[model samples]
Target: MNSFDLSIETYLSNIHFGHFATLSIQAIDNLYTFKGLVLIPVLWWMWFQQDECHEWRREMVLATLVSGIVALLVGRLLTHWLPFRVRPVYDTELHLRFASGEIKDAVLTNWSSFPSDHAMLWMAVATGIFLMSRRVGVLALLYTALFICLPRAYLGFHYPTDLLVGAAVGIAITLIMTRDAIRVRYATPVLRWTERHPAPAATLAFILCLQLVTQFDELRKLASGVMKHL
Candidate 1:
């Protein structure tokens, strides 16, 4: 590991018993709940759909979905198939737990903590949207930092390095997809014609329908996990 990685590990280790760490973990874990994950996306999409930049909305939506899915799949495969790392909660030597109190039985996984899923997801969304609107992009980045990154570290689910790496992956995927989308959506004569006379309402509806269909499998999985926990 490099000096940066070592520094992060040391920092995480030092905070094992801190009250702030306990609070951060709790806040971070709360974001994994169904409402935070699902409702936020729905509201975000709805808001953007109503924006005046309707022509760019489709590109933004497509980029967000494609980059997010790619990041998630790649992150999962890398974490699961590569050398696995136990979470701090499961590390007896670390003795990390809720500093406020003892945690109840929680569903834990023994996966590598190199790239945090939450960080990647939000970062992908932020990056994709940033390609569309700078203001929205800034807001998205802030949301990811305050809600996703900070909370995950506070809760011991991931080190700061994991979140940082995940953000990098998300940003990279977003940039690639956005560049490709621009090339495909604008470079073609037929596409340029369509853009000049955009069917915003119709396009928005179609994209929304596609999103609902594409998200069904993921939503089902999330529901199943919630049921299992319940």
Candidate 2:
């Protein structure tokens, strides 16, 4: 890490340990669930119900999500070309809140941490929202910075520049998606197909979402419980 990356990353790369600390970590780690799943939907729903252009709002929401996933993929590919770096905990002498009891699966040591997929996805959604409502977009940006980026840094998952460049990738892709020509050429067709087959489209979205987020405490527990009988 260069001085800029190291200075900011070091400033952020410390955490508390214990049960409460675990809870806090899990909560921040679920920033995607709230911002992407909860907040974005809520904002879109509010706008949709009030707007004369309900269909447009619906299509835009779907397009925005697609943009987020695409941004994540693009960022993922970018990491392969950059100098390799392991997750902060694995590569550096940072203080970590290992399994002090908030939860298990305390450390993920091998994953590449060059550009954060979380940063890319969250910023893509934020960019999409900002396109619609500046206030909501700014709010989402703040939440992404504090709740999403900070905790990941504190927990030793990423360097600040990793998150920063990932955000840049997301913003770039989302801005392209927001273009009128691109929307007319690409997004409209996808929306039309989705309108024609909402069930399959919804199913595909759920599956892709599963690929994006691997940690789900309740869901994992439920899956484990079900597997015990088999």
Candidate 3:
């Protein structure tokens, strides 16, 4: 809890956009809930667009997905290994002014907030898009900042540094994975298999995307329950 993170949270928590507070909060909530679904179309656009480098683009998409999962796993592992950091709302020192309609999640109260998986996962996807198309990638990054990361920060679910580190890790992994040599060596085989086994590939893709959309909430809940029984 450095002064920098505290300052940003303090400033954001204090301001409520008078007449638009409810509407703004609703919009942010919706963005958080549906962010993964929102990215699907953008990724589809990148994949299916008429381009000479069709195969490369397809390979890049697989690499991006792999990077996102890897980055998120790294972030979650760090949360468990590093000294636990509490979210701003849960920090007794902060006394954050809760946003209208933003109730704390009892389930997440004990979770470490040092590095946000949200930023890590989405930034990786955004970086991959940027690798393929600069214009759309820029928009994706901005949307991530404003819609995804900012909402979490304002609502006190994460500190600014958490988002920054997460984004850096995500972007670095994505950049490395999308390199031509790396994609050709790893992603190319996966793409070839998908081409050969279309039905099973589609089924698996649907499951993966479903997990992404829910941020693995169901899987986490099941794991938590199992741990309790043990």
Candidate 4:
């Protein structure tokens, strides 16, 4: 790590000031992994059958999912192909700079720390929400940065550069997915196919979501391993 990256990593790692704050950050860390997916339920609850933009919202949600998947893939490839870096808690040099008695999970091992998959997912959804509604998007972006991003950094699961690069990848993927050319060339055809076989499409989406929530870690590790060799 360079001087700036190490400095920020050191500063963030020392942020678990008190017991209450430590507990809160830990809770946020757990919640952060699913913050993006949480939007799915919110959209479902808020979706209106007669709304003029109903189709837009529906399409945006699918686009967000696809973009997140693309970001995940890109991040995994970079992480595996790039030089490996250690997490703060596991970094011998950085551990000395960490605040003791807070958020040290044994499972937080040293790994490829150039980019964070968690940030990619959260930012992808945040960007998608922005495209759908400006007000909600602004709020969501702030919420993601403050709650999800900060907690992960404070807890040492990612470095500042990791979060920054992951978010850039995420925003890029979502922006590309938002492009008219991509939508016309790919998304429209897929949407038309789904419309003709709504039941099957819905079933597949449901199954994919179910497996994601239940076996996320397992699948992620497997994907990383597969990507590493590819």
Candidate 5:
């Protein structure tokens, strides 16, 4: 970690909100719940809303969702392929303070923290939303920054640089994936397929959304289990 990361971590650690620390921890723990509640509704509205450019909006949303999945895959691959960096919460040298003192049970002890997956996934989704609709997209970005990324730093799960790099990667990949040519070639066809097979498509979309909300935890666990025996 550089001086910037250390200074920021130190500053966050120094501030204590007393009993509010527990509440903050709870908020951090339950953040995934908010994902389905907030993002799913916004996505649903974005997909079905009637407007002059509704078709483009729907296609863009599809591209954005596809990009989100790709960004997450990239994040996971990078985390494993790159050097394993210790999380701030688990770093003994940092001696960071955990006001709630309950973080150990709540966080992943084994995962690397650099280029946070949370930032990559959510920021990509938010950037896509912003590209589709400025007003709602701004709200989504603000929510991701404050409610999603900030809490991870506050809880010492990630350094600021980790979030920054992950978000940059996410935004960049989404921008590329949602380009007119790419969307026309890929997302448009998928959208048309869904239109033709609404029942199965809806079921698969629901499953994918559930995975996004949970950060693919069960899927990862199952993959790990399968890999162990192979």
Candidate 6:
């Protein structure tokens, strides 16, 4: 109704209309599936295995995972609790259904459309990974943009602006949490504790806890899928 909403609606309608959207939706979703779930983690593990930052790696990994989860949850809450923007597909007068049956019904999510969750989660993980390695971060961001963010727009699930804002929120959260001063301040007590304790055991326990938390969503999804199949 206001200028911003009007602008967003107009933009969504414009982008959701043709051959481009058809190509982008499928392409982006597939990219998200492959890059987010498979490639990034595999690459992270490979790199992490060879990492020399033994002291810093565990701390950074813990910070990244915790901060990333918080960012994702905040983003989801903001999108869901704020104004409920409709997806382009449901705006019938807009007539933006480009290709029929190309998108999965499960993906045709009925949630509020502003601030896309896929974009938020991808950006969060990308930001977290970026804190570990700049080169890897850049690749992660590119993967998010090309495969996750772009496809959401193409598939009529989100406006370009939604992805942009979601990404900003994700990155902002990561930066706040992983800033050097914050890290030093938070890690000081933990470091002191480790100094008086078995450092390796403490670090291992910390990493295991983080690994479990980080994989929670993926595991839940996998379990749900398995249950449905059964």
Alpha carbon lDDT of residue 197, candidate 3? 100
Per-model TM-score, in order, reads 0.65, 0.74, 0.92, 0.83, 0.93, 0.67
Tell me how candidate 4 scores on lDDT: 0.71
When summed lDDT is taken over every stretch of 10 residues in candidate 5, the lowest stretch is 98-107
lDDT of 5 at 74: 97
Task: Please give the lDDT score at residue 10 for candidate 4.
Answer: 71
Where in model 5 is the C-alpha error above 4 Å?
A: 100-107
Question: How do these models rank on TM-score, best leading?
Answer: 5, 3, 4, 2, 6, 1
lDDT score, candidate 1? 0.62
Cand. 5 TM to true fold = 0.93
Where is model 1 more than 4 Å wrong at Cα?
Answer: 1-28, 32-53, 95-107, 180-230
lDDT of 2 by residue, 11-122 (tens): 6543446778767676767555644565455444543475676656656666676787688777767777777777765653544333222332433444478788788887
In model 2, where do residues sit more than 4 Å from their true spots? 13-22, 30-35, 43-50, 93-108, 198-230
Task: Encode model 6's per-residue lDDT on 1-230: one tens digit a residue.
Answer: 34664465566445544677565566546543444564346334633464577557656655665566676678768866898777665656665553333344553455677787666766876887777778877888887787777666655667667788888887887788778889767655665566578678557655644443343456657877999999
For each of the candidates, the C-alpha root-mean-square deviation to the true structure, in angstroms, is 6.4, 5.5, 1.9, 3.5, 1.8, 6.0
Q: What TM-score does structure 3 among the candidates reach?
A: 0.92
Say which candidate scores most in TM-score: 5
lDDT at 84 for candidate 1? 71
Write the residue-wise lDDT of candidate 5 on 20-131 in tens digits.
Answer: 7658665764667765357656887898889899889988888887888999999999998999889888888987885535456533677889889888998999999999
Q: Please give the clash total of every predicted structure, in order.
A: 2, 0, 0, 0, 0, 0
Candidate 1, 71: how far from true, in Å? 1.3
